[model samples]
Target: MIEIKRLKFSYGETPILNIDELLIPYGEDCLFLGNSGSGKTTLLHILAGLIKPMEGEVILAEENITNLKTHEMDDFRGRNIGLIFQKHHLVHALSVIENLLLAQYLGGLPKDLNRIYQALDDVNVLHRKKAKVYELSQGEAQRVSIARAMLNKPKIILADEPTSSLDDENCERVIELLQYQAEKYDATMVITTHDQRIKKRFENSITLR
Candidate 1:
């Protein structure tokens, strides 16, 4: 589970995020909807422990990570959270399997070839395991990203505008894959986006102004 209290973050003199209180229970999927500059991504970053809030408590599970040091935060995030981005940030020079292995390594997890293969297969990208990352199409690459996100068996999966550029079919595919896999792992799934097309897919939602 995750909880935020009186969260306030700013860039210079401008306040970018000011969440009062938010809680996400374990093993659930929640959509975060908002307009541009409404702090959706900022909130996701705080949840993932990527951005330290200027003042507030970001509690994951039962630990408050707001005061965790950079290195400690990195390790903690690697083990507890999976972050997926809209651009499908795969290493262009790495093979598909290598890309996944890299993610696991970064997360401080032991590599499991079988799990890797299974995740790739789930996304219908197993055949491309030996192919270079740059060789994949947008959808294919996004599938790989999903596979990598689940690689660490994280407690929470955080996605930022994942389906922003995807077509309807691919968008649905991505959403279903995240939801199903998160359920399988009992990981809370939180997706932050500006797209209204994704609103109807989930019942619980957090809307920011």
Candidate 2:
């Protein structure tokens, strides 16, 4: 489960986000809907421990991560949180398999080629395992990104505007893929987006303003 209590965030003196209390149950698929500048991405970053809230407590999977040191937060996030951004964020110079290997390395996970291959296969991109990220189509690259996020079988999946850049068909496909992987791992999935196309797809959503 994920919990946020008395959350408030600001940049310098400008406020960005605030929430009194929010709870997302374990294994639930949830959405945070908002417009641009609504602090949706800021909230995701806070949840992922990439940014610290000025005053708040964030608990993920029963662990209170807000008090963790920088390195500790990094380690926790690496192991328990899988993140997907609007951009694919893949290294163009590296092959798909190499990219996943790097993720495993950063996550402090042992090199597991079998797990990497299975993750790629889950996204239907196993055939492109040896291909450089730059050589793949937009959709293919996104699939590889999904595979990398699922490589660790994280307990929480956080996606920020993951489908904003895709066309209608690819957008639906990406959402399905994310949902499938989340269910496969029984992980809590949280997506933050302003895109209205996907609003109807999720049954539970919190709108931020």
Candidate 3:
């Protein structure tokens, strides 16, 4: 679950986000709709603890992340949050399974091969586990990214502009995959995008100015 209160973020003298209060309950899926420059991604970063707000609190699963120390926040984020960015961010040279192993190592979690395989299997990418990231098609790469994000069984999944570059079919497929993985793990899903193709997909949503 997530809660934010009096949240405000700015860059230099300009304000980016000024949310008063927001909440998303456990296992819920929410969409953040916004035009370009509307701060949808900024809000997502704040929720993920990747950026600090100028004032207010971002509480995730009962802990106020805004107050956590750098290392503490890093540990909490790695353990509790999964991030899927517009870019896959996979190491092109590494195989799909190797990329996942690296994620676990970077998160300071033990390398659980079985968990990696399960995640890949859930995303329907198990057969491509040994292929290099650069060798995958766009859809396959995206699925691999989802697999890596879910490998840790995070409590919240934050996806930023996930379907922005896809065609209609791939867009729907990605959304379905995201929902499936989130439900499978019982993780709250929050996606930020300006894509109208998915506007009606989520019942819980908010639009940013």
Candidate 4:
């Protein structure tokens, strides 16, 4: 489960995000909706432990992450939090499979080729596993990114502006894929987006102004 209370964040003197209390149960899906400056990404980053909030507590999987040390938090995030960025950060110089290997290596997990292969197959991008990242099409690259995120079998998945650049059809497909993957792994999925196309798809949503 994920819970936040008395949450607040800022950039120097400018306040960015504030929340009194929010709770999301395990295996649930939620959407954070807002316009460009609504702090949606800020909230997601805080949840991912990428950025610290000035005040309040963030509890994930029943642990108070706000109190964790830097290295502890990094280890926790690597093992429990899966992140999907707005841009696919795959290295163009590396093959698709190599990128996933790097993810596992950085996470301090042993190299498991079978896990990588299953993840690729699940995302329907196994055919491109040996190809360079640049060789995959936009949609294919996104799938690879998704596979990488799920490679660790994270308990929580955080996605930032995943469908902002897609057309209607592709937008739906991407969201569905994310939801399916989250459900398959029984992970709590949180997506932050300004796109209205997916707003209705999520029953539990929070709007930030």
Model 1, TM vs. native = 0.96
Q: Which candidate would rank higher by lDDT, 1 or 3?
A: 3
> Can you write out model 3's per-residue Cα lDDT over 56-148, one digit (the tens) per residue?
999998899999998999999888999998878889988999999998987889989999999999989899999988899988998899899
lDDT string for model 4 (22-129, tens) is: 999999999999998899999999999988899999999998999999999989988888899878888888999999999898787999999999999999999889
TM-score for each prediction? 0.96, 0.98, 0.97, 0.97
The predicted structure with the larger lDDT, 1 or 4, is 4
Question: Which residue pairs come into collision in candidate 2?
Answer: none
Clashing pairs in 4: none
lDDT of 3: 0.92
Instruction: Find the number of clashing residue pairs for candidate 4.
Output: 0
Off by over 4 Å in 3: none
lDDT score of model 2? 0.94
lDDT of each: 0.90, 0.94, 0.92, 0.92
Pick out the ten consecutive residues of candidate 4 with the lowest summed lDDT: 85-94
**Candidate order by decreasing lDDT:** 2, 4, 3, 1
TM-score of 4: 0.97
Clash numbers, per candidate: 0, 0, 0, 0
The runs of at least 3 residues in candidate 2 whose Cα sits more than 4 Å from the true structure, single-residue gaps closed, are none
**RMSD to native, candidate 1:** 1.1
